[model samples]
Target: MSQATPPRSRRVPRAERREEILAAAARVFGSKGYRAGSLAEVAEQVGITHAGVLHHFGSKDRLLWEVLEYRDRVDVEHLEGQHIPGGLELFRHLVTTARRNADRRGIVQAYTVLTGEAVTDGHPAADRARTRFGVLREDIASALRTVADERGVDLAEQDAVRAASAVIGVMDGLQTQWLLDPEVVDLAESTAFAIEAILRAVLPGVEPLPDSPGASGAP
Candidate 1:
């Protein structure tokens, strides 16, 4: 007996289909690396033809950027869903994100591999990676300042910027360490520990961190 093959149509809604394509592309690129990933492969994964994939993305490079942007949005969404009462809390968020990244191996691979390739001039996601990190710093800095306002302590602009940058740097650095040795780093736990040490610096007069990063689980 012959089985029915589902028809491919734009009926899934353009935006949703685009997300599906981007998610599939991320997994493929994460596994194969950008240069090695091809439209044919992505199409195969999406249950479509190469032409069908190009119809939505124009080209493989465009598809890659969409995947990066998707990841960036997810990252921002995670932070948006939480409240960090002080600068140290922001650190806690970053550290917890590191832990979550470690737990989700595929995402960690996708982010690390794409960013590594992104450093090359003219790489499709190079500008996006730069913009994404800059925006992330701004978001965290804003929250830190809010904490400062609440505490009635005004840190110098340089201090806030430095603190935000330091948090981002530590996260990126720790992610790499965790990637290299998950057993040794256990990124999430280590993140909480590291950020806990910085608590005194950022929350000088604020109430202490809750028993568990304000009830957020898995970063």
Candidate 2:
């Protein structure tokens, strides 16, 4: 005798469905680090079976990468869009993105755990992490270069890269700090403070010429 096909409920649209699954993965991984998280739980969160989840994403690692990719996409969509960030708004975006890292602990855990594991030379996320950071660093450096141009200040690409590294370091360092002591931070404010200092050092006339807009100064 032939077996009957399982009944199919209404299906969400493909892209929407993918995003929903990724969202669930983020929540699950946030609660239980990547290795400890199960495809089963992710499927359950999305009201589907483990096989259904695998059918969409193939495996746990694939799903994890999607989550990471999604976060990166979100960053680009907001921070580096056609709307060029400038003035205090640019600083706010920098500080805000850094602060937002705290809310993305699963991504941070994946980064930290992967970086630690990468020391073994042939670990799973080793090359992926290395490439990811390199691209991220370059993008940040490019943004800083733009900011410097907007302020009419010329900076060497090396200087731009160094500033970019320092800014990215704040986010990475803050993630490490918060994972150790969540209570000790107000990430938004702390990041603002850090970037403000960095800006003061790098942006020249803009820093000291305060207390009044157009305060006998020009960028």
Poorly placed runs, candidate 2 (over 4 Å): 1-8, 12-14, 31-37, 75-91, 205-219
RMSD of each: 4.9, 8.3
lDDT of each: 0.66, 0.66
| Model 2 C-alpha lDDT per residue in residues 71-148, reported as the tens digit of each score | 666654644453425444555555555555666666667666655666586777677778877876776667667767
- Please report the TM-score between candidate 1 and the true structure: 0.72
**Decoy 2 TM-score against native:** 0.73
Error of 2 at 91 (Å): 4.3
What does the lDDT read for residue 69 in candidate 1?
A: 69
lDDT of 1 by residue, 1-219 (tens): 012222455366767767777767866775665567677877776667888788999987667667766765664454545333344455555655565565456556556766788999898778888997888778777877877777788667777777777767777777778878878987777766655555446657555444333335543
Give the TM-score of each candidate: 0.72, 0.73
